[model samples]
Target chain A: MAAISVELFAYPWDILEATPERFLDHCVALGVTRAHVTVSYHSGKFLLPRNRSVRVYFPEPGALYFQPDAAAWAGGLAQPVSRLAGSGWLERLARGAAERSIELSAWAVFFHNSALGAAYPDLAVQNAFGDVYPFALCPSHEAVRDHAAALCRSVAALGIFSGVDLETIGYLGYFHGHHHEVTAIPLGMAEKFLLSLCFCPACRAACGSAGVDAESLAAAVRGLLDRRMQSDDASGGQDEEAEHVATLLVACPALAALIRLRMETVTALVKRLSVEAGSAKLAAFTSSFVGSPSNIWMEGVSPTDVGELVECFHLLAYAPDVAQVNSELVFFLALTSDPARVNLTLNLGLPLTTSFSQAAAKVEYALRQGVRRFSFFNYGFLGEARLRWIGDLARIARGDSR
Target chain B: MTELRAGVIGHGYTGKLHASAWLANPHAALTAVADSDASRLAGLPAGVRGYSAYEQLLADDLDAVSICLPTHLHAEATLEALARGKHVLLEKPIADNLRDARRMLMAAKAKGLTFYVGMTHRFYPELREAKAQIDAGAIGEIVAANDCVLEHLGFLNVPQWYLEKKFAGGGAALTSGVHLVDRLRWFLGDDVRAVAGRAGNSYFGADVEDSGQMFLYFRSGLSAQITFAFMREEHPLVCDLQVIGTRGSLTVHTWQSYELWNNSGRQRKVFYTQEPHPAKVQAGIAGEVEEFRASIVEGRTPWPSAEESTRAVQAILAYYESAATGRLIEIGDLHAV
Candidate 1:
């Protein structure tokens, strides 16, 4: 059999304050041949005293801190905690992994500048509602992309991590605007919000090239809102009042093209960033039943559409390992049965109630169907109760006991 | 002065529910019930009458009627009631499509009758409290919100009318999802300007969508994500709302409990659950009945005019447009279409 390697991915949140010695012991005990360490650092808020040659605004409440001055918002980068913790822990883990011959990857939440948004208002995503979102940075913005690249480079240079994993970029829905937070505005306000997007010259030019009539789209949304209000009003604004709201139907082909364009932009950015970090190998963990064909969220796309989306991702060269499938058992079976051509390792992470025997059965079944690798989400989250199966997993990985 | 008599058409599930609410209230008399199924209309309380045909039931001295027919016959039955000058309480969605909805609205308007659509979740106590708080600006400028409804197989039992495109305009989105859309629009205190949606029939192989997700943009620059699906087993029917603002945040869980978090003080306040106000339900029916009665009595129009219903139908059409086309469809564009 091919060498069974057990790789453990560690989240940054779990080891923010952990000592290197503690991590090494844990890794050794868990039989983790390779560990992925995450380093995340953020400052909470900044106070800008007027006439001090700088202006600052604290958009979010916690996690980001910075001094309000020219030195802070401009090129004022804080030290990454992963750099501090990994320096010592990575050495020990590296020595342990060398002796045990394990690999390591560094995990990072990519394109997320929640800290920057909180500390520096200038870097925040501004919504049409005049509210600044502190937890999200616009992927379309150049400054935001640069900041993300710098962070990626810093993590890559750590030398201890074999790879880097980036998370949560441009996944926020269409109405998210510049704010990371979701909002409830009247339906009548839709047109005003649509005008808020593509404000960046680059986005505008891109929309122009794509032949997207942003203004007309905004007006259509506005008209729909007005119609809804009028309907509700006609029903006397009563809950049980039945009122018919008019629907504005657009041609399907046009919509499909628009969605393709948007997807292309986002995927291109992802590929560019992955290649730039020298971590050409990428993995994307998507909920098993999201987007088109399996629109678990009811996002209006169909299962066939979702299959098309998966193909799109593949065309962009995203490996199957990058597409982490998530769903209940029945849905998982359905996804595996699709005719869509995919050639990546399918990682199945289900609830903890699944027994080792059952898991083995599943693994065996998947393996029979061309699955080459499998992994449990987290050994730590399993606890010590019935989670001793993790040891079995380690043995299986070592190919000595399983 | 004599108390007005009222009859309910189609005494099925929703019809029974309406009957119970009406019986508990003292505003109007439950005069009769009509159903094509004799077995369904077999039993009746002492003072109430039952009929197999709606025309025969309308011949009774009843002043108003609640048309709780299946989706396919909503327009026909409602029009019949309005033509007879009887007030109406029609169950949602108002009709199967924009054309039917408009026809119903126009007919009701031409006859100067009372027409009301049943969207009962608005009567939930927690939602009422949240609306009050929002109107008071306790949450400041509203920013975003999310609404989720999950079920394992809620659509399996949909009647044949729902399966026929000639009856149920769309699928789960038009049926169950419409509730969330209406509630979100109500809570946001604005209209839904544009919508981008994705829907599919994953669990069930029906042509209609069993699951859907909608991203709504409001006129006030507020954004929301509304998710509806038939894919959960044990989770309670949760119609929850989370509204963020400049000053505080207000969340209503399960549509009956309220929680408010003040941004400035960093304090969270939980509100007690209140009983569903009977007066509100009665008031809706009462207003609808009074409009019809007044139109007949004094020759005037109703407050919740047919023009309003036309707008709502247009909005529903817009949702279908966005869902079918996969584009952010504008609501007003439907007017010309």
Candidate 2:
């Protein structure tokens, strides 16, 4: 098998709290050559079980971990920077990574910012019911798209990054995590798709420009969704996801056309961001929350389309065993033109992986299938044992079992 | 209402227990029942109308219904009955999810019907006595607790629907585990601030978990460990609760017995049941039925109100969420989805 390149996903708090030298040295020893460090991200209650201090870390909502040039925000959304970032933590970490020859890539999350959405409610994704999902920014808006591009340009302008990992560049759905959220209603794939469909003014105008009747589509979604909500319909199973989407598309061709427009919108935005990333390799991740590589169109992401635009397409193989990982890989790889461009990103710890053998088997299988790149998710969440597992995995990937 | 007319839906195991409870309650009349299977409806008592479809039974005049349907059917059947202005005594874990449970509660409230979630385990003699002792300061300054239930009542022998998450919400965690969780919430108060759990289908190879474990942290500086396993018959069946307090401690085995002890470990009190397990369980169900009937007649909220039951459901759902994400989930973050 060919040797593989390994990347470790990390956050600024993980490195700053644990000290960058120790964190980066640990990554280098584990055979990680690149660190996809979080630069700009959304809010979440993250558990840092392996951190030297701080068991739980709540990130500043939609804050940039690095200083942004004022010129980048001239005509875009406000840039919220973390207190630590303003205090030069990002610069310190960048220096540490450069000293170790570890390529530091900027991982920026766009459009999934509750802070920006809250600041500009009109730019947030408005569902069919006219309810604003302040957690997700509507990508169809010119300002939101400009802000994302600006984010890329600013991170690239920092001149310390090798690549930019663009996440959530498309639309975030209704099921996006909100604080104390209670969506206990079992929603099927079709129902979720309808609920996720953005009807914001910009989205409506985009559809309208494409000769699709936006109002009628919104009415249809509202009616179908209302019936499902008011009635006692049991949710459809995962196996029925394709069937559900197919049936909905067959019944509502306008929705199908509208979805096509959404995919186009996301693809166009990614292309623009790639251009904005001056000489830095632009990478796009598969849909994390809303959909997978197979049905990412629901999140307005056509995997093959976006896969063509970026240097790497990172697919989250967050499954328990080799079979599930294989299935996710098979489905994702089938959709792309070049399988080598796909990087398999797996979680190093539980709920996704438990043992080195289980994780290694997935890596070996991916290697045998011509995938020579892997990314281990989250340096902060894993403990010593799982960290060692990643080290073993790196050796296995390099054809040196010892 | 001098006498409440009662109907029992779903003639399964819980359905039969509910039917017997309605018949045994003096203030309630067992008037009708519905079951999907004709064989289950064969032995309906004289003058008690039987229908294969619950809808037909709902059309009949009834003041209340003992909705012993499967977890998935709970929302639909209860909502229909509530729409007809009938009181609902829904079986535990209220519904498959919180949204349906909330809807059922709202429908009952809008119609001014008594909505009770039947948690028979709470009415178990030993458990009831344990609660009474704790309330009476027999166990002072409660500090910690553990609740565990292990039995062979899982995928192999139960209804097929119980194995599917779409039908059952979850396996052992939401099914039998919810009872222990509910009892803990009742004993310690609804102060579960966060939960961390582990669940899986280690046995039976079913889609849902056959065994589950949860660590709950209460806001009152108390913590609890809750475990449930729907294991093989060879595994000794145990339904146990042990609570530790500053002054004393107590242990209770549902339907069997309980023991209390002082700080020095001297046995202060002990109570054991001579009755068989099945009979004691039936008696507990009967007690809940009587409570439901009294609540309707006296226009009072039942012992375990809809909100309380929703809390149990929320806790179980949070446990499931924690298990899936492998993270500590705050109970406050739980909402209907």
Leading candidate by lDDT: 2
lDDT of 2 by residue, A156-205 (tens): 88988989998888888864667787765677767877888999999999
The 0-to-1 C-alpha lDDT of every candidate, in the order given, reads: 0.52, 0.81
How big is the RMSD of model 2? 27.2
| Candidate 1 whole-model C-alpha lDDT, 0 to 1 | 0.52
Error of 1 at A52 (Å): 58
Candidate 1 segments whose C-alpha is farther than 4 A from its true place: A1-402, B152-166, B232-234, B264-313, B333-337
RMSD of each: 29.3, 27.2
| Inter-residue clash pairs, candidate 2 | A182-B335, A182-B336, A183-B336, A183-B337, A184-B336, A184-B337, A185-B337
Query: Candidate 2 lDDT, tens digit per residue, B26-81?
Result: 87799999999875676467899999998999899998999988788888989998
- Roughly what TM-score does model 1 have, to 2 decimal places? 0.42
- Chain B TM-score by candidate, in order shown: 0.84, 0.94
Q: What's the lDDT for residue A174 in model 1?
A: 34
Worst 10 residues of 2 chain B by lDDT: B268-277
